[model samples]
Target: MATFTPPPTDTMRAKLLLAAREEFAAVGITGARIERIAASSSSNKAQIFHYFGSKEGLFDALYAQTLAETLALVPLDAEDLPEYAGRLHDAAVQRPWAQRLVTWYRLERGDAAPMEAVVASNAEAVAEIERAQRAGVLPRTLRPAVLLGLVVHLAAFWSETSPEFDTLVTAMMPARRRQVVVDAVAALVRR
Candidate 1:
Protein backbone atom coordinates (compact mmCIF):
# COMPACT_ATOMS: atom_id res chain seq x y z
CA MET A 1 0.00 0.00 0.00
CA ALA A 2 1.12 3.56 -0.74
CA THR A 3 1.66 5.95 2.16
CA PHE A 4 -0.71 8.90 2.50
CA THR A 5 0.59 12.39 3.35
CA PRO A 6 -1.12 15.67 4.05
CA PRO A 7 -0.25 19.05 2.56
CA PRO A 8 2.20 21.27 4.45
CA THR A 9 0.91 23.72 7.05
CA ASP A 10 2.53 26.68 5.30
CA THR A 11 0.83 25.79 2.03
CA MET A 12 -2.56 25.59 3.70
CA ARG A 13 -1.90 28.89 5.48
CA ALA A 14 -1.03 30.62 2.21
CA LYS A 15 -4.24 29.39 0.59
CA LEU A 16 -6.22 30.60 3.56
CA LEU A 17 -4.58 34.01 3.38
CA LEU A 18 -5.32 34.33 -0.33
CA ALA A 19 -8.93 33.27 0.10
CA ALA A 20 -9.33 35.64 3.02
CA ARG A 21 -7.95 38.52 1.01
CA GLU A 22 -10.47 37.94 -1.78
CA GLU A 23 -13.31 37.60 0.69
CA PHE A 24 -12.38 40.68 2.67
CA ALA A 25 -11.92 42.73 -0.45
CA ALA A 26 -15.31 41.72 -1.78
CA VAL A 27 -17.38 42.17 1.40
CA GLY A 28 -15.12 43.57 4.11
CA ILE A 29 -14.33 42.20 7.59
CA THR A 30 -17.79 42.52 9.10
CA GLY A 31 -19.47 40.79 6.18
CA ALA A 32 -16.90 38.07 5.49
CA ARG A 33 -17.69 34.52 6.68
CA ILE A 34 -15.23 31.94 7.98
CA GLU A 35 -17.17 29.17 6.28
CA ARG A 36 -16.74 30.82 2.89
CA ILE A 37 -13.04 31.41 3.45
CA ALA A 38 -12.46 27.81 4.46
CA ALA A 39 -14.50 26.54 1.53
CA SER A 40 -12.56 28.71 -0.92
CA SER A 41 -9.20 27.68 0.50
CA SER A 42 -10.01 23.96 0.38
CA SER A 43 -9.33 23.84 4.11
CA ASN A 44 -11.44 23.66 7.22
CA LYS A 45 -12.55 26.25 9.81
CA ALA A 46 -10.57 24.46 12.51
CA GLN A 47 -7.36 24.99 10.57
CA ILE A 48 -8.09 28.70 10.20
CA PHE A 49 -8.67 29.06 13.91
CA HIS A 50 -5.55 27.08 14.63
CA TYR A 51 -3.45 29.21 12.30
CA PHE A 52 -4.88 32.65 13.05
CA GLY A 53 -6.86 32.35 16.28
CA SER A 54 -9.93 34.22 14.97
CA LYS A 55 -11.32 36.16 12.04
CA GLU A 56 -9.94 39.42 13.40
CA GLY A 57 -6.57 37.78 13.82
CA LEU A 58 -6.63 36.61 10.23
CA PHE A 59 -7.46 40.12 9.02
CA ASP A 60 -4.61 41.56 11.09
CA ALA A 61 -2.14 39.13 9.57
CA LEU A 62 -3.35 39.94 6.07
CA TYR A 63 -3.13 43.68 6.77
CA ALA A 64 0.45 43.40 7.97
CA GLN A 65 1.49 41.28 5.01
CA THR A 66 -0.17 43.68 2.55
CA LEU A 67 1.53 46.67 4.14
CA ALA A 68 4.94 45.01 3.93
CA GLU A 69 4.34 44.11 0.30
CA THR A 70 3.27 47.66 -0.54
CA LEU A 71 6.37 49.11 1.06
CA ALA A 72 8.60 46.73 -0.86
CA LEU A 73 6.87 47.38 -4.19
CA VAL A 74 6.41 51.14 -3.89
CA PRO A 75 9.47 52.71 -2.30
CA LEU A 76 9.51 56.50 -2.36
CA ASP A 77 11.89 58.45 -4.53
CA ALA A 78 11.89 61.82 -2.83
CA GLU A 79 14.04 63.38 -5.54
CA ASP A 80 11.25 62.77 -8.09
CA LEU A 81 7.91 63.22 -6.39
CA PRO A 82 5.99 63.16 -9.67
CA GLU A 83 7.49 59.85 -10.68
CA TYR A 84 6.89 58.52 -7.19
CA ALA A 85 3.26 59.56 -7.36
CA GLY A 86 2.88 57.98 -10.79
CA ARG A 87 4.35 54.73 -9.54
CA LEU A 88 2.06 54.83 -6.52
CA HIS A 89 -0.90 55.39 -8.81
CA ASP A 90 0.10 52.45 -10.99
CA ALA A 91 0.53 50.20 -8.00
CA ALA A 92 -2.86 51.20 -6.65
CA VAL A 93 -4.44 50.42 -10.00
CA GLN A 94 -2.62 47.10 -10.32
CA ARG A 95 -3.36 45.86 -6.80
CA PRO A 96 -6.74 47.37 -6.09
CA TRP A 97 -7.37 44.86 -3.30
CA ALA A 98 -4.86 46.76 -1.17
CA GLN A 99 -6.98 49.91 -1.37
CA ARG A 100 -10.14 48.00 -0.54
CA LEU A 101 -8.39 46.36 2.39
CA VAL A 102 -7.34 49.76 3.71
CA THR A 103 -10.91 51.02 3.40
CA TRP A 104 -12.15 48.01 5.30
CA TYR A 105 -9.55 48.51 8.02
CA ARG A 106 -10.49 52.14 8.49
CA LEU A 107 -14.21 51.33 8.56
CA GLU A 108 -14.14 48.22 10.76
CA ARG A 109 -10.99 48.37 12.89
CA GLY A 110 -10.18 52.01 13.48
CA ASP A 111 -8.49 51.30 16.82
CA ALA A 112 -6.10 48.67 15.57
CA ALA A 113 -2.37 49.36 15.69
CA PRO A 114 -1.08 50.57 12.35
CA MET A 115 1.50 48.56 10.46
CA GLU A 116 4.87 49.80 11.76
CA ALA A 117 6.51 49.39 8.40
CA VAL A 118 4.03 51.77 6.76
CA VAL A 119 4.52 54.38 9.47
CA ALA A 120 8.30 54.14 9.28
CA SER A 121 8.27 54.29 5.50
CA ASN A 122 6.04 57.39 5.51
CA ALA A 123 8.34 59.08 8.01
CA GLU A 124 11.35 58.27 5.87
CA ALA A 125 9.59 59.72 2.83
CA VAL A 126 8.81 62.89 4.78
CA ALA A 127 12.46 63.28 5.76
CA GLU A 128 13.50 62.78 2.16
CA ILE A 129 11.02 65.45 1.04
CA GLU A 130 12.54 67.86 3.56
CA ARG A 131 16.01 67.16 2.25
CA ALA A 132 14.85 67.78 -1.30
CA GLN A 133 13.26 71.06 -0.22
CA ARG A 134 16.52 72.20 1.36
CA ALA A 135 18.36 71.38 -1.86
CA GLY A 136 16.01 73.64 -3.91
CA VAL A 137 14.52 70.64 -5.76
CA LEU A 138 11.03 70.91 -4.23
CA PRO A 139 9.17 73.86 -2.78
CA ARG A 140 9.80 74.64 0.90
CA THR A 141 6.50 76.40 1.58
CA LEU A 142 4.44 73.26 2.22
CA ARG A 143 5.01 71.12 5.30
CA PRO A 144 6.67 67.81 4.51
CA ALA A 145 3.84 65.73 5.92
CA VAL A 146 1.22 67.72 4.06
CA LEU A 147 3.14 67.40 0.82
CA LEU A 148 3.52 63.68 1.26
CA GLY A 149 -0.18 63.35 2.13
CA LEU A 150 -1.18 65.26 -0.98
CA VAL A 151 0.98 63.13 -3.23
CA VAL A 152 -0.26 59.89 -1.70
CA HIS A 153 -3.88 61.02 -1.87
CA LEU A 154 -3.56 62.06 -5.49
CA ALA A 155 -2.14 58.69 -6.39
CA ALA A 156 -5.02 56.89 -4.71
CA PHE A 157 -7.76 59.25 -5.82
CA TRP A 158 -9.22 57.07 -8.50
CA SER A 159 -9.11 53.86 -6.45
CA GLU A 160 -10.37 54.87 -3.00
CA THR A 161 -12.40 58.05 -3.36
CA SER A 162 -15.47 59.25 -5.27
CA PRO A 163 -17.31 56.56 -7.20
CA GLU A 164 -18.74 59.25 -9.50
CA PHE A 165 -15.28 60.43 -10.42
CA ASP A 166 -14.20 56.88 -11.03
CA THR A 167 -17.16 56.39 -13.36
CA LEU A 168 -16.20 59.48 -15.36
CA VAL A 169 -12.59 58.35 -15.58
CA THR A 170 -13.65 54.90 -16.66
CA ALA A 171 -15.24 56.35 -19.78
CA MET A 172 -11.93 57.82 -20.90
CA MET A 173 -9.14 55.87 -22.55
CA PRO A 174 -6.81 54.20 -20.08
CA ALA A 175 -3.84 56.18 -21.26
CA ARG A 176 -5.72 59.42 -20.76
CA ARG A 177 -6.42 58.56 -17.13
CA ARG A 178 -2.77 57.66 -16.61
CA GLN A 179 -1.61 60.89 -18.22
CA VAL A 180 -3.97 62.86 -16.06
CA VAL A 181 -2.39 61.35 -12.95
CA VAL A 182 1.14 62.04 -14.19
CA ASP A 183 0.34 65.62 -15.20
CA ALA A 184 -1.49 66.38 -11.97
CA VAL A 185 1.39 65.07 -9.86
CA ALA A 186 3.93 67.00 -11.90
CA ALA A 187 1.96 70.20 -11.53
CA LEU A 188 1.52 69.75 -7.80
CA VAL A 189 5.18 69.05 -7.03
CA ARG A 190 6.74 71.55 -9.43
CA ARG A 191 8.53 74.46 -7.74
Candidate 2:
Protein backbone atom coordinates (compact mmCIF):
# COMPACT_ATOMS: atom_id res chain seq x y z
CA MET A 1 0.00 0.00 0.00
CA ALA A 2 2.97 2.32 -0.30
CA THR A 3 2.82 5.13 -2.83
CA PHE A 4 6.50 4.66 -3.64
CA THR A 5 6.32 0.89 -4.18
CA PRO A 6 2.95 -0.76 -4.04
CA PRO A 7 2.30 -4.49 -4.59
CA PRO A 8 2.42 -5.62 -8.19
CA THR A 9 -0.82 -4.63 -9.96
CA ASP A 10 -0.90 -7.63 -12.30
CA THR A 11 -3.99 -9.84 -11.92
CA MET A 12 -2.04 -13.09 -12.47
CA ARG A 13 0.60 -12.11 -9.94
CA ALA A 14 -2.10 -11.22 -7.43
CA LYS A 15 -3.80 -14.55 -7.91
CA LEU A 16 -0.52 -16.39 -7.48
CA LEU A 17 0.24 -14.53 -4.29
CA LEU A 18 -3.25 -15.28 -2.95
CA ALA A 19 -2.83 -18.97 -3.69
CA ALA A 20 0.73 -19.02 -2.39
CA ARG A 21 -0.27 -17.45 0.93
CA GLU A 22 -2.48 -20.41 1.82
CA GLU A 23 -0.04 -22.97 0.47
CA PHE A 24 2.91 -21.59 2.39
CA ALA A 25 0.94 -21.16 5.61
CA ALA A 26 -0.43 -24.66 5.47
CA VAL A 27 2.72 -26.49 4.36
CA GLY A 28 5.52 -23.99 4.97
CA ILE A 29 8.28 -22.96 2.57
CA THR A 30 10.02 -26.34 2.31
CA GLY A 31 6.81 -28.25 1.74
CA ALA A 32 5.26 -25.80 -0.72
CA ARG A 33 5.41 -26.97 -4.35
CA ILE A 34 5.21 -24.81 -7.43
CA GLU A 35 3.01 -27.30 -9.26
CA ARG A 36 0.31 -27.23 -6.58
CA ILE A 37 0.52 -23.48 -6.29
CA ALA A 38 0.23 -23.05 -10.04
CA ALA A 39 -2.75 -25.39 -10.19
CA SER A 40 -4.50 -23.52 -7.42
CA SER A 41 -3.96 -20.15 -9.05
CA SER A 42 -4.92 -21.41 -12.50
CA SER A 43 -1.38 -20.50 -13.51
CA ASN A 44 1.50 -22.68 -14.61
CA LYS A 45 5.07 -23.04 -13.36
CA ALA A 46 6.33 -20.89 -16.23
CA GLN A 47 4.17 -17.96 -15.24
CA ILE A 48 5.16 -18.21 -11.62
CA PHE A 49 8.81 -18.36 -12.59
CA HIS A 50 8.39 -15.38 -14.87
CA TYR A 51 6.75 -13.35 -12.10
CA PHE A 52 8.61 -14.37 -8.95
CA GLY A 53 11.78 -16.06 -10.28
CA SER A 54 11.58 -18.89 -7.72
CA LYS A 55 9.67 -20.41 -4.81
CA GLU A 56 11.69 -18.53 -2.23
CA GLY A 57 11.13 -15.28 -4.01
CA LEU A 58 7.38 -15.88 -4.08
CA PHE A 59 7.36 -16.78 -0.38
CA ASP A 60 9.37 -13.70 0.52
CA ALA A 61 7.04 -11.41 -1.39
CA LEU A 62 3.92 -12.88 0.24
CA TYR A 63 5.44 -12.81 3.73
CA ALA A 64 6.52 -9.20 3.27
CA GLN A 65 3.02 -8.24 2.18
CA THR A 66 1.48 -10.13 5.07
CA LEU A 67 3.72 -8.29 7.55
CA ALA A 68 3.12 -4.91 5.95
CA GLU A 69 -0.63 -5.42 6.15
CA THR A 70 -0.34 -6.32 9.84
CA LEU A 71 1.72 -3.20 10.58
CA ALA A 72 -0.71 -0.96 8.73
CA LEU A 73 -3.78 -2.55 10.32
CA VAL A 74 -2.46 -2.85 13.86
CA PRO A 75 -0.25 0.10 14.73
CA LEU A 76 1.02 -0.30 18.29
CA ASP A 77 -0.64 1.48 21.24
CA ALA A 78 2.02 1.53 23.93
CA GLU A 79 -0.08 3.47 26.42
CA ASP A 80 -2.88 0.92 26.14
CA LEU A 81 -1.05 -2.40 25.87
CA PRO A 82 -4.09 -4.39 27.00
CA GLU A 83 -6.33 -3.12 24.24
CA TYR A 84 -3.47 -3.33 21.77
CA ALA A 85 -3.02 -7.01 22.59
CA GLY A 86 -6.75 -7.59 22.29
CA ARG A 87 -6.71 -6.03 18.82
CA LEU A 88 -3.82 -8.28 17.82
CA HIS A 89 -5.82 -11.31 18.99
CA ASP A 90 -8.75 -10.12 16.91
CA ALA A 91 -6.52 -9.77 13.86
CA ALA A 92 -5.10 -13.29 14.23
CA VAL A 93 -8.59 -14.71 14.53
CA GLN A 94 -9.78 -12.77 11.50
CA ARG A 95 -6.88 -13.90 9.32
CA PRO A 96 -5.78 -17.29 10.62
CA TRP A 97 -3.25 -17.59 7.82
CA ALA A 98 -1.43 -14.50 9.05
CA GLN A 99 -0.42 -16.20 12.29
CA ARG A 100 0.45 -19.45 10.54
CA LEU A 101 2.57 -17.58 8.06
CA VAL A 102 4.44 -15.89 10.89
CA THR A 103 5.21 -19.26 12.46
CA TRP A 104 6.39 -20.56 9.13
CA TYR A 105 8.51 -17.49 8.55
CA ARG A 106 10.33 -17.92 11.84
CA LEU A 107 10.88 -21.65 11.50
CA GLU A 108 12.24 -21.40 7.97
CA ARG A 109 13.81 -17.99 7.58
CA GLY A 110 15.13 -17.61 11.13
CA ASP A 111 17.60 -14.72 11.57
CA ALA A 112 18.69 -15.07 7.93
CA ALA A 113 15.87 -12.83 6.85
CA PRO A 114 15.68 -9.74 8.98
CA MET A 115 12.61 -7.94 7.77
CA GLU A 116 13.08 -4.18 7.84
CA ALA A 117 9.39 -3.64 8.58
CA VAL A 118 9.53 -5.81 11.69
CA VAL A 119 12.77 -4.26 12.96
CA ALA A 120 11.54 -0.69 12.47
CA SER A 121 8.14 -1.47 13.91
CA ASN A 122 9.64 -3.07 17.02
CA ALA A 123 12.03 -0.13 17.50
CA GLU A 124 9.19 2.35 17.20
CA ALA A 125 6.98 0.40 19.61
CA VAL A 126 9.81 0.04 22.13
CA ALA A 127 10.46 3.76 21.96
CA GLU A 128 6.80 4.53 22.48
CA ILE A 129 6.65 2.19 25.48
CA GLU A 130 9.73 3.80 26.97
CA ARG A 131 8.26 7.25 26.54
CA ALA A 132 5.01 6.10 28.13
CA GLN A 133 6.89 4.53 31.03
CA ARG A 134 8.88 7.72 31.65
CA ALA A 135 5.63 9.68 31.62
CA GLY A 136 4.18 7.27 34.24
CA VAL A 137 1.53 6.06 31.81
CA LEU A 138 3.03 2.56 31.72
CA PRO A 139 4.75 0.79 34.59
CA ARG A 140 8.56 0.93 34.73
CA THR A 141 8.86 -2.61 36.08
CA LEU A 142 9.86 -4.37 32.82
CA ARG A 143 12.18 -3.27 30.06
CA PRO A 144 10.23 -1.79 27.16
CA ALA A 145 11.16 -4.54 24.69
CA VAL A 146 10.39 -7.35 27.14
CA LEU A 147 7.04 -5.80 27.98
CA LEU A 148 6.22 -5.44 24.31
CA GLY A 149 7.26 -9.05 23.61
CA LEU A 150 5.14 -10.32 26.50
CA VAL A 151 2.10 -8.43 25.30
CA VAL A 152 2.56 -9.68 21.76
CA HIS A 153 2.96 -13.32 22.84
CA LEU A 154 -0.03 -13.13 25.21
CA ALA A 155 -2.15 -12.01 22.27
CA ALA A 156 -1.34 -15.27 20.43
CA PHE A 157 -2.48 -17.60 23.22
CA TRP A 158 -5.08 -19.24 21.06
CA SER A 159 -3.05 -19.30 17.89
CA GLU A 160 0.17 -20.83 19.26
CA THR A 161 -1.28 -23.34 21.73
CA SER A 162 -0.52 -27.05 21.55
CA PRO A 163 -3.21 -29.45 20.33
CA GLU A 164 -3.86 -30.65 23.90
CA PHE A 165 -4.16 -27.06 25.09
CA ASP A 166 -6.44 -26.27 22.18
CA THR A 167 -8.79 -29.08 23.17
CA LEU A 168 -8.86 -27.87 26.76
CA VAL A 169 -9.83 -24.37 25.67
CA THR A 170 -12.33 -25.36 22.99
CA ALA A 171 -15.21 -23.92 25.00
CA MET A 172 -13.56 -20.55 25.59
CA MET A 173 -15.55 -18.65 22.99
CA PRO A 174 -13.96 -15.90 20.90
CA ALA A 175 -15.05 -13.06 23.20
CA ARG A 176 -13.63 -14.75 26.28
CA ARG A 177 -10.38 -15.58 24.49
CA ARG A 178 -9.91 -11.93 23.56
CA GLN A 179 -10.74 -10.81 27.11
CA VAL A 180 -8.14 -13.22 28.50
CA VAL A 181 -5.42 -11.66 26.33
CA VAL A 182 -6.42 -8.13 27.34
CA ASP A 183 -6.65 -8.97 31.01
CA ALA A 184 -3.32 -10.79 31.02
CA VAL A 185 -1.59 -7.80 29.47
CA ALA A 186 -3.35 -5.48 31.87
CA ALA A 187 -2.07 -7.52 34.82
CA LEU A 188 1.46 -7.49 33.39
CA VAL A 189 1.32 -3.74 32.82
CA ARG A 190 -0.02 -3.15 36.33
CA ARG A 191 3.18 -4.58 37.75
Candidate 3:
Protein backbone atom coordinates (compact mmCIF):
# COMPACT_ATOMS: atom_id res chain seq x y z
CA MET A 1 0.00 0.00 0.00
CA ALA A 2 1.08 3.59 -0.64
CA THR A 3 1.57 6.10 2.12
CA PHE A 4 -0.74 8.98 1.21
CA THR A 5 -0.15 11.04 4.38
CA PRO A 6 2.79 12.81 5.92
CA PRO A 7 5.25 10.71 7.86
CA PRO A 8 4.22 9.44 11.26
CA THR A 9 4.57 11.84 14.16
CA ASP A 10 6.33 9.23 16.24
CA THR A 11 10.08 9.81 16.51
CA MET A 12 11.11 6.20 15.96
CA ARG A 13 9.08 5.97 12.79
CA ALA A 14 10.67 9.14 11.46
CA LYS A 15 14.17 7.89 12.22
CA LEU A 16 13.48 4.60 10.53
CA LEU A 17 12.25 6.38 7.46
CA LEU A 18 15.31 8.63 7.35
CA ALA A 19 17.72 5.77 7.74
CA ALA A 20 15.87 3.61 5.26
CA ARG A 21 16.05 6.29 2.58
CA GLU A 22 19.83 6.12 2.36
CA GLU A 23 19.98 2.35 2.73
CA PHE A 24 17.39 1.76 0.07
CA ALA A 25 18.97 4.24 -2.29
CA ALA A 26 22.34 2.62 -1.94
CA VAL A 27 21.31 -1.00 -2.53
CA GLY A 28 17.78 -0.83 -3.86
CA ILE A 29 14.74 -2.77 -2.58
CA THR A 30 15.94 -6.22 -3.56
CA GLY A 31 19.34 -5.67 -1.99
CA ALA A 32 18.30 -3.59 1.05
CA ARG A 33 18.79 -5.14 4.47
CA ILE A 34 16.28 -4.65 7.23
CA GLU A 35 18.94 -5.36 9.84
CA ARG A 36 21.17 -2.58 8.53
CA ILE A 37 18.34 -0.10 8.39
CA ALA A 38 17.23 -0.99 11.90
CA ALA A 39 20.73 -0.78 13.30
CA SER A 40 21.48 2.47 11.50
CA SER A 41 18.36 4.04 12.89
CA SER A 42 19.07 2.69 16.39
CA SER A 43 15.90 0.67 16.15
CA ASN A 44 15.43 -3.05 15.72
CA LYS A 45 13.81 -5.56 13.38
CA ALA A 46 10.65 -5.93 15.44
CA GLN A 47 10.21 -2.18 15.59
CA ILE A 48 10.56 -1.91 11.81
CA PHE A 49 7.96 -4.59 11.26
CA HIS A 50 5.68 -2.85 13.71
CA TYR A 51 6.07 0.54 12.11
CA PHE A 52 6.03 -0.28 8.37
CA GLY A 53 4.73 -3.87 8.24
CA SER A 54 7.58 -4.91 5.93
CA LYS A 55 10.56 -3.71 3.93
CA GLU A 56 8.35 -2.97 0.94
CA GLY A 57 6.09 -0.94 3.16
CA LEU A 58 9.02 1.11 4.43
CA PHE A 59 10.07 1.81 0.82
CA ASP A 60 6.56 2.95 -0.07
CA ALA A 61 6.55 5.34 2.86
CA LEU A 62 9.94 6.81 1.91
CA TYR A 63 9.02 7.09 -1.77
CA ALA A 64 5.75 8.83 -0.90
CA GLN A 65 7.57 11.24 1.37
CA THR A 66 10.14 11.95 -1.30
CA LEU A 67 7.45 12.67 -3.88
CA ALA A 68 5.62 14.94 -1.48
CA GLU A 69 8.76 16.91 -0.72
CA THR A 70 9.60 17.35 -4.42
CA LEU A 71 6.07 18.43 -5.27
CA ALA A 72 6.02 20.94 -2.46
CA LEU A 73 9.38 22.27 -3.65
CA VAL A 74 8.46 22.69 -7.36
CA PRO A 75 4.75 22.55 -7.97
CA LEU A 76 3.45 22.32 -11.51
CA ASP A 77 2.76 25.59 -13.27
CA ALA A 78 0.84 24.29 -16.26
CA GLU A 79 0.77 27.73 -17.88
CA ASP A 80 4.52 28.08 -17.26
CA LEU A 81 5.70 24.60 -17.98
CA PRO A 82 9.17 25.61 -19.17
CA GLU A 83 9.96 27.19 -15.82
CA TYR A 84 8.48 24.21 -14.07
CA ALA A 85 10.77 21.88 -15.98
CA GLY A 86 13.78 24.04 -15.14
CA ARG A 87 12.82 24.03 -11.47
CA LEU A 88 12.45 20.27 -11.50
CA HIS A 89 15.88 19.94 -13.09
CA ASP A 90 17.36 22.18 -10.41
CA ALA A 91 15.70 20.20 -7.64
CA ALA A 92 16.98 16.95 -9.11
CA VAL A 93 20.49 18.36 -9.29
CA GLN A 94 20.36 19.41 -5.64
CA ARG A 95 18.72 16.23 -4.38
CA PRO A 96 20.36 13.49 -6.42
CA TRP A 97 19.30 10.85 -3.90
CA ALA A 98 15.66 11.59 -4.62
CA GLN A 99 16.26 10.63 -8.23
CA ARG A 100 18.09 7.47 -7.21
CA LEU A 101 15.26 6.48 -4.92
CA VAL A 102 12.74 7.05 -7.69
CA THR A 103 14.82 4.96 -10.08
CA TRP A 104 14.87 2.15 -7.54
CA TYR A 105 11.14 2.46 -7.01
CA ARG A 106 10.38 2.07 -10.70
CA LEU A 107 12.78 -0.85 -11.07
CA GLU A 108 11.62 -2.77 -8.02
CA ARG A 109 7.92 -1.97 -7.85
CA GLY A 110 6.92 -1.75 -11.48
CA ASP A 111 4.40 -4.55 -10.98
CA ALA A 112 3.13 -3.36 -7.62
CA ALA A 113 -0.16 -1.66 -6.95
CA PRO A 114 -0.41 1.97 -7.99
CA MET A 115 0.92 4.45 -5.45
CA GLU A 116 -2.07 6.53 -4.36
CA ALA A 117 0.05 9.61 -3.69
CA VAL A 118 1.71 9.44 -7.11
CA VAL A 119 -1.60 8.83 -8.86
CA ALA A 120 -3.21 11.76 -7.05
CA SER A 121 -0.24 14.05 -7.71
CA ASN A 122 -0.14 13.24 -11.43
CA ALA A 123 -3.91 13.58 -11.67
CA GLU A 124 -3.79 17.08 -10.21
CA ALA A 125 -1.05 18.12 -12.64
CA VAL A 126 -2.88 16.64 -15.61
CA ALA A 127 -6.06 18.44 -14.59
CA GLU A 128 -4.17 21.70 -14.43
CA ILE A 129 -2.61 21.07 -17.86
CA GLU A 130 -6.07 20.40 -19.25
CA ARG A 131 -7.34 23.64 -17.75
CA ALA A 132 -4.43 25.53 -19.27
CA GLN A 133 -5.08 23.97 -22.64
CA ARG A 134 -8.77 24.89 -22.53
CA ALA A 135 -7.80 28.50 -21.81
CA GLY A 136 -5.30 28.37 -24.71
CA VAL A 137 -2.32 28.75 -22.40
CA LEU A 138 -0.66 25.45 -23.28
CA PRO A 139 -0.65 23.85 -26.71
CA ARG A 140 -3.24 21.18 -27.50
CA THR A 141 -1.22 19.22 -30.03
CA LEU A 142 -0.09 16.70 -27.41
CA ARG A 143 -2.34 15.19 -24.76
CA PRO A 144 -1.93 16.63 -21.27
CA ALA A 145 -0.57 13.39 -19.87
CA VAL A 146 1.86 13.00 -22.73
CA LEU A 147 3.01 16.57 -22.35
CA LEU A 148 3.53 16.06 -18.67
CA GLY A 149 5.56 12.96 -19.41
CA LEU A 150 7.72 14.80 -21.90
CA VAL A 151 8.42 17.66 -19.52
CA VAL A 152 9.29 15.34 -16.67
CA HIS A 153 11.57 13.22 -18.82
CA LEU A 154 13.25 16.27 -20.28
CA ALA A 155 13.94 17.54 -16.78
CA ALA A 156 15.80 14.32 -16.06
CA PHE A 157 17.97 14.52 -19.14
CA TRP A 158 21.23 14.89 -17.27
CA SER A 159 20.39 12.36 -14.64
CA GLU A 160 19.47 9.77 -17.30
CA THR A 161 22.37 10.50 -19.62
CA SER A 162 24.95 7.86 -20.44
CA PRO A 163 28.69 7.96 -19.78
CA GLU A 164 29.19 8.91 -23.41
CA PHE A 165 26.77 11.79 -22.96
CA ASP A 166 28.68 12.94 -19.90
CA THR A 167 31.90 12.93 -21.90
CA LEU A 168 30.32 14.82 -24.80
CA VAL A 169 28.98 17.57 -22.56
CA THR A 170 31.85 17.73 -20.12
CA ALA A 171 31.97 21.53 -20.25
CA MET A 172 28.22 22.19 -19.97
CA MET A 173 27.58 24.37 -16.92
CA PRO A 174 24.66 23.91 -14.54
CA ALA A 175 22.80 26.86 -16.03
CA ARG A 176 23.16 25.44 -19.52
CA ARG A 177 21.95 22.01 -18.39
CA ARG A 178 18.82 23.50 -16.82
CA GLN A 179 18.23 25.70 -19.87
CA VAL A 180 18.29 22.66 -22.11
CA VAL A 181 15.36 21.26 -20.17
CA VAL A 182 13.49 24.57 -20.04
CA ASP A 183 13.98 25.22 -23.76
CA ALA A 184 12.81 21.73 -24.72
CA VAL A 185 9.61 22.13 -22.73
CA ALA A 186 9.07 25.60 -24.13
CA ALA A 187 9.29 24.27 -27.67
CA LEU A 188 6.82 21.52 -26.87
CA VAL A 189 4.24 23.79 -25.18
CA ARG A 190 4.59 26.87 -27.36
CA ARG A 191 1.19 28.32 -28.21
In candidate 1, what are the lDDT values of residues 46-111, reduced to their tens digit? 999999999999998898788778878988887788778788888888999999998999899888
Deviating ranges (above 4 Å) for candidate 3? 1-9
lDDT to native, each model: 0.86, 0.90, 0.92
Candidate with more favorable, higher TM-score: 2 or 3: 3
Candidates 1 and 3, the one with greater TM-score: 3
Collision count of model 1:
0
**Over 4 Å off, model 1:** 1-4
lDDT, residue 55, model 1: 98
Model 3 score (lDDT): 0.92
**Better model by lDDT, 2 or 3?**
3
Which prediction has the highest lDDT against the true structure? 3
Cα-based RMSD of candidate 2: 5.5
* Candidates ranked, most accurate by lDDT first: 3, 2, 1
- Among these predicted structures, which one has the highest TM-score? 3
lDDT of 2 by residue, 96-137 (tens): 999999899899988576878778877988999999999999
Winner by lDDT between candidate 3 and candidate 1: 3
